[model samples]
Target: MLDDTLRPAPPRRGGWAAPAALVSVTLAAIAGFLFLMMVTGGLLRWSPLPPGSPADTSGRVSLPAEVGAPGIWTPDAMAHPIPAAAVLISGNTWYADDSEFYGGLVGAGADDYRVLDNEGAAGMASVLSPDGRRLASGDGILDIAAGRRTPYPRAWTDREIAAQAWSPDGTRLVVTSRPVDDEPYAAPESLALLDTGIGAITELEGSSPGLDGWTAAFSPDGARLAYPAGGRIRILTLASGAMLDIPTPGGAMPAGKGAWTRDGQGLLTVAGEHCDTCGDYPVSWTVTTLSASTGAIAGPQYRLDGVYAVRVLGWWPSGRPVAVAYAPAPGTPATLFDDPGTQAGLSGLTTVGTVRVLELTPGSDHAELAAAATESIDVADDVLAAGTLRDGRRPLTSVDRLATGVAWFVGLTAAAALLTGAYAVAQRASRRRSPGMSTGIADSV
Candidate 1:
């Protein structure tokens, strides 16, 4: 009998290398395919939506980078007291875009609430005067402090104020209303407060204006009134009808759905300055006292949330209400953020300052992106980098660099696969050339 080794080893010559090559080819193909997918992957590519379809991992969903730590309310050099972005704040007043809900806006000055939908537009507004004089709305913009209704460029008249509540002293009432306007919803005719007290409501020729404003309030002394315009926060004095332009503490810009503070010295309005809106986030908070007379900002307060929703009691016997505050981060020293519109529009930033945090894009890893967020969803590197918001930093993923990395990996993998095939073929040829080779070549030459 022939020795086991010499028994013309049938075509049992196939080894693990053959299967191994197949795996390498599969792997090389997979690597190349994955790289392509990484570049052109995700729902955003084909959905026609904007590039960064915000998933909002940083506690803000209204607009990108809008919300901050909601529980922080104490005022200080570093307090994240404002609730950034828009919220449905339910209280004595309940508001709905449909007007079906029963409520008002004067309670919290939430009248500035804007839906984070296809547009920054608001549906209506519930306006109040400073001295508890007027409450109303219309296809026009209501100058809150002035207690005057100015016809809006757009005409939205169906919006209505669902409820109305007065401040402790009855000087102001929180009216539930939407503040922006659009197509059939022009004029922000959402909700409003028609001050039975204001002298100007008589100017609208009576009738309270625009679904007649809703839920109004008064300051502790009943001297000041608060309410919302489009994105404007208005504070008026009953005796003078003097309108005070209040600046939202952080990045929050009033849209409506707000009210007067306990002191009735300030007005509270839902505010937003999402990284999407601001396009960048400041590293610190800006505290400025604005002129109730001219919409001009003044004095510096402190740096809290880079962006947040703020409440202001217009005029206080003890001056502005000083909220006790603190920062969420331990090592990040607080610095005043900037508000450029502080003077020009009573809409700019103030108390400007800077922050330095890592950057991230909207489409980053599902788990890692949120972990990378510094404060809220509105917190962008550009928004939080420089104090003055001068195109601070870039958030894009650097597609070119990513592409280079993938190319390198694919090339290396292909080379390794080719080398394996060459080696395998050589080994088989060597065995066939040896006088001891018994396996016949499947494809003969």
Candidate 2:
């Protein structure tokens, strides 16, 4: 009874549908783009969000500004091609500190770094055993090829072992300890030698006072332990149980870890510039050798002219002392170092300019610039602060990550709904034009 022209209009979708759908798709694309931008904020260098985003979408975790000088073989270099915070060189292979908190062995020609894990292997403050087949840490000793860990002696359970060094024969460990049963563990009160074979412990006590609990370097023959006590180098002869204090002129304090020379005749140590008239902070530092026999200063005291702080890494195979030097961060007040509360330590200081390497020959009064690091070293700050381990980055809080997911979901859902609506409308129009399709709903007759 109704003419085709007058027939009831085919069901029309909402007038706002098309425009709203288009707007949603556009918004979704923008959101997806922003997410991508956030993901690669550092690589390509633009961020969609203003300076302060709820998430820490920022720079990439990159290698140190520069690699160590060629042939220098630094841990940062051995971690090469990746970055490592700690490295130990044993002969030809390099052991780097990886996630296990122990050393991960990697060879120059090897494909990957090796890690070890087992019951007692999980620990911190790692050092490689002399045999190169074992790795020792605060918790236990890991047998590299065996994938096994031997826990420390039960007697050390209640004590916090602060420092450890292996005997040259790989049969013993010299450790310093302090009790940690609830009370704060103070400077090491006891130094002991433990025979790894039988687990027997021997106390090294001759002067009543304990050696530096934080660090001790063994002589090449393992006959003595060289430590710092009250700004002087102390050599403890294990065979005779004698303690000798090496006097340093001008009240110079030991600045970093010391190592024994290849010949073991003198000890390598970095000394702080003595300032009797000044306050707590030393103005500069110098690398010098001390006579192993008498603890007397020997050789030239090579003072790094512009270096503000120094870390004596170890001795290179060629007997050159390997060290990392740091300069003050730009704009840091010159007076900052003078303030004890200003928050600069071995690990916390932010450095400006390229970190330079210094290799001083044992007897030289001057140092050779081994190599220059490519970029400034920022020791403490981290960039990938907002991803998950499941993702590539450290995670933001659960709520923030959830919100990011939801935003993505909503954008996509809106786009899907828009397309679905358009499809339904198109199907209706197609049926009307074909003339054979029927609206399934028939008249109530």
Candidate 3:
């Protein structure tokens, strides 16, 4: 009879070959996908999705007068002018311990959309000049109409710079400077005024140590600067560098970046009543005005309800308060205030559901929606041109969709690689245990 061992080893059914092939295929597919995305992104000006019509078809883009003279902005014709009232929208990608943000400029009056390629993080708090021609951020200065950038002066290379606000004439920027190695949430070491025209910096007194996340604002006339520090609002006169400390109510702080009343007399700030012992979350929020000249409360404080938090961005031209409001998502715990230890701030509030830019009128509790987003949204404090409200929600742009797809692809590829490796290991172990099987078959044959 034919030896049973001489059955050709039954063709060695299911070795590592299948798994190895699968691993190779998965790697190749991932590589191809990344390459395709890169090429497509480059060709489409990094914006694969359509950005509605252009706001200005003058076909002539010019640098801000402060940066450069009027002329053709850049060789690339795709760069267009951004409107003054445009609000920045960010879509966030969260990892296990960190997150990345990406988005662009969008306006309510016109469908003017400009994608911010490299300034996704900095652009969130960037301030536009009163004239709406220049945009300033921690990175540098950008010509809103020309799509050009000017780097910060070389003297600032050793320090971290955070642009707080711009002077009324658009020639100067109020910025805070801290050592590069300092914790991001720590208060700034110094505050200075940067002359965008000459690239000069003038340091100011009364730096707020141990208090971070407070934004500074220039009075409407540009004579004084209002900022929160030491649990009070400090007004600094630019000419004499004299400071006035305006005490805030108990358990109250400057809401978002504080804004000056249109008449340049009072300061508008949001105050949150929180019971730290009970929970870090605020129980209620209010939009209150304080006298810029004195520390006393100016007008009646308006209670803002139905929202988790409200940040006073700036005042609309119509004398109404413009703000960005946050609401907790369903199933989100009430204790989910943003961890102050991390740079995530509002963007890291994973439980936040809806974000809306609203125009808060004094008498009515209902806010007029200027723009809305699912993740996060920010508007330049001084750039609410015409104070127009769109009353619409932001749609998912192409960048957001692409980011989501890439994230999924990476996750699946990693999982597949791990499984393939495990299978190969198991197959090798089985072969090692039965080392004599192949030899016996060959001898019988």
Candidate 4:
């Protein structure tokens, strides 16, 4: 107290330290939050949902459901249960509860679901060979066409069953069954030419290499069969008994699903170049005369973009120029469904004489119904070629295609950004406490 030279140091108030520290921490947190908001918001904003998305909102994951048997509704085959084992003429006529199994080929175009063992459906029976003639329908089956009844092989034959198809002449049934039995034709997959006329089934010798499945399609002339084997395009000659693999550019041929051209010269892919998952599906596909007889890729690969689920819109009687229903690229200046009436009239795709063209209208979305095909889906080229096209033919938008891709990326990008920001925030908190622990925070500090 007596020393005048000692002056007290300025007071460092406790309040000052607490406020300053708090302000600094708040500012840091706000800055970090803003940085995160800037990056995360913009990053995911550009994502878009793909076109043609299903009802699934859980992203690509699908949940399984247990449903009871669905009803079988059909005009031709009503008062009976369509066999879960037979070929269904229409998709609407089968059990919704069961997965895709054909209504067994029976009845005057009707049949019951057959069980294996050739006994009553209670027995373990598989698909019967394409038998045109049957006096008594197999258990749970019916008879439709005119054919004599014959007994199936006693022991289960080696033949593997495939999706059924009609031959060009309608005399034979082309189904993808290999060897007609398990022993001789071990290749479990082959296109079998069952001669309904002569009652002889010939296994087409040269398969398009690895081509399997019931998706095997035949041209109307009974000459060529187009199939995808081992993810490549190939054509088989029914007449010549030859299978030639088509050459693709750069790498391998597209392994997408394929359909025949009207003339049977070209094939359509369900997806195309951008569709990596679908293996090249597409809206349009044509097999031009661009290939040599040797089956080489000669001209530009013709394809239409953004279409799927190609149904038999119609067929030209001349055997060329099929009528296909397709929508335009999803977002282009196009309308959806093109009225369900609109059809693409294609020229060529036939060996018949006159130019094979679709009967399209100028202003209307629906196809200009040809006078000949007015009664049915098959339009005769001769009757319609000289026939004029209706006015107002315009293309519609294909909704499903673009949506598929857009939706995938949108979800992916959003999830990525959100997860990234979450990780960043967690890392900042750890850094404030530990200073240098995890590599992520340690580097930042």
Candidate 5:
């Protein structure tokens, strides 16, 4: 027999050994990376969804410059001891998109923020109860303190439901429902009041053909509801089942949603001015106070300038007007408000810029910033009305950024390796099937 050491290694029966080894190594590397991330994340106390903690009572927190560097942020103090909460969306690399983001109560310097468990809860239109104990969404009610979710009753399960506004007493919710298969932009098929206590449903009349803006507001005392319908503000008295329609001025339309003044004497609606020459962008916006009794103009009509857009959230307990101020982000298009109709519609633009919760001071153009985020930030109407917002700060950590980069690298490497392995398998099989053919060149060791 020829020297055993020189015998050409049995011509390597299977070409899968190299690929198999590569796959095994890739798996081991992935597991090791995961373990390292876990350890580092724990040591850093950083997570996309952090657990709840007691309210921060150490006073207003002044955030560092990094807090404004495109990530989820929270305030360190509240102007007053009220249950104010907000939904914070991350602007970081990993959670930049609509599907991947963080959402929950912002805690408003009270308790540590809590993340919602429901899918797409981050983007859903949600409102806090008057007492701030519960949050209502299309899925159902979430008890904040108890951490429990109660789905809607069977009677309303067939239709797609969205929480519009909660009664001042928190006993009832104004909800809009549409057929499950209906187009998202299509008007709601019906509007109704759902009793939170007994799970009862009372459908409202004249809500068909639906409301134009898909948003409604309860008066301060919760006696009436105001919504935009058929190009006019429609006020419905809950007890009498009577309806009142207030027409908007020419060339002006309801902007997103409206809020009832603290005194309940007027309804606050954003009047978006249309300009044919201005292209798709709005010429200007004005927070018009319409009379509750008549369609006539009521109180101060503040012309909101120096901002891209504004949404009338509600009034603070101090009677100061509060709203969301949207400032154009770097690459924001001029057609930002081309479809200024509903809260859900406008929410799609949060990624277009920075959102600031502002308390518009009466008799002054200066607006005090309550809270802000680099991306989207939505506070509950009740929270804005009942609680006080103060300036506070928190810094963003590097752990999340590092983790995101590492995750991307690992994913790409594994994918490339797997593809290479598959190609090798295919080549080996082709060679085995064509065993009768021979190449002029011999295989090298």
Candidate 6:
């Protein structure tokens, strides 16, 4: 028997250690769970299936299998394939692009699509003259009646005229140009004035110094030009080089060239707004008009009901706006790019539907949808061709990328905390089991 005087002390339980570790584990787990949710949410956002496309629980868009093309649809020249750019319908005739490739201009006054045989392979931005006698394309003016080309002088032929709009009088042309193969004019010195009568080329300098030039439309009276840049439409005076900026509503930037109202009092274009609360994808866009004189919003944002992915094409003769809309069966959400944060306020959505012309009428407070665009998967391309392809398609804006980065950081931090807390608890338990530890037990002598 061991001596009574030499009794071993009892091992003391850590009074605060276990409970503190448990508390840490609980808090860390909660944080980690929140972070996990954020990461999953980001992934789901760009998944190919979403609430607005195809068939969804939202019941906005649902279609049968025999409807539009599936994953990828082959485009045909005879059919009105999705227009690659600008669309204009005047008189009884409509002109539109049959493809993005060269010499894709097609025209139709009747139901069938016909190739504009007189169109050349130059791929210049072409617009019909006021009298509708000729098509002015780039530095080369195409005389439809004569079936001949009037080339600009060698001195006037350096720049690639990307976009041009004829003045109401047809004597002047407001042209936007870039390098030869650069489809969208991105250069700072892209604006120029062309005097058609004398072939005089005057380089103008009123475009946004901070942004690349997109769409340019001459005012009805030829006194001003309205174009979109950096979330606003700028009206530049031809005589004084003065400029006025009109901001789009809901902080959405103007997309495409500003479409002039018949009275030239308002400018129309598609505008987009970002939504953070939207689970996977976070952008919503619609078409609206801005008053030229006062910069006031003329109406509510017009969108196709249940159609989330739509791009403004231009206006029709009946005063309706046309757009290319995409709707697929709802599934997972996915985007064109992993993230499209640099595409200035673009929603970064890829569509699978057809073009829609909305019949919205202006009213006292806002515009009302007089008649919804017909849901036709196929339509012949008539009277709506022969201009620069100004389809407003782009990726995400910088703001969207910033939001993604924030979500990732919070998730990572929470995961680290959870892991560290678990490691600390294990270390404490291991220390308690070491041989050097003594138990508080008495030994009888």
Instruction: Give the TM-scores of the predictions, in the order they appear.
Output: 0.32, 0.51, 0.64, 0.36, 0.64, 0.46
lDDT of 1 by residue, 165-280 (tens): 33434333334434333223312233333343442221111122212121133445557554444334456566776766455444333322223333333343222232433213
**What would the per-residue lDDT of candidate 6 be over residues 1-445, giving only the tens digit for each residue?**
5433434455755555556567656766655665565455432221221112211122111111111111111122223222221222111011111222222222212111112322211111445554443455553665533445677656645655543456767787766655565543333345677888998877765453212213566665678877655556678888898889887564443333325665678776554445555344454455677788767877445643344344433454565544444342245233221124333211211222223333344421222211111121111112222211222211221113434555675666566656666777787787667655344455775
How much does candidate 3 score in TM-score? 0.64
Model 6 is weakest, by summed lDDT over 10 consecutive residues, at 63-72
Residue 242 in candidate 4, Cα distance off native in Å: 4.8
Q: CA lDDT of each candidate?
A: 0.31, 0.46, 0.56, 0.32, 0.56, 0.42
Q: In angstroms, what RMSD does candidate 5 have relative to the true structure?
A: 11.6
Pitting candidate 1 against candidate 2, the one with the higher lDDT is 2
In the order shown, the candidates' Cα RMSDs to the true structure are: 16.3, 14.3, 10.8, 19.8, 11.6, 17.5
lDDT of 4 by residue, 1-445 (tens): 2322434444433433344445545555555554454344431121222223221222211111111111222112222222212121111112222212322222212122111112211000122222222211122223333222343233215544433344444454544444543433312255455565455667653453322221355564657766555544557787777877664332222221123545555553322233333223333333232242444543333333343312222233433333333232323222111112221111001111111113222121323232110001111122222232322111011112223333554455555555555665675575467533222212221
Model 1 — TM-score against the truth? 0.32
Q: Residue 39 of model 5: what lDDT?
A: 55
Model 2 gets an lDDT of 0.46
Q: Candidate 3, residue 67: CA error in Å? A: 29
Poorest stretch of ten by lDDT in candidate 4: 346-355
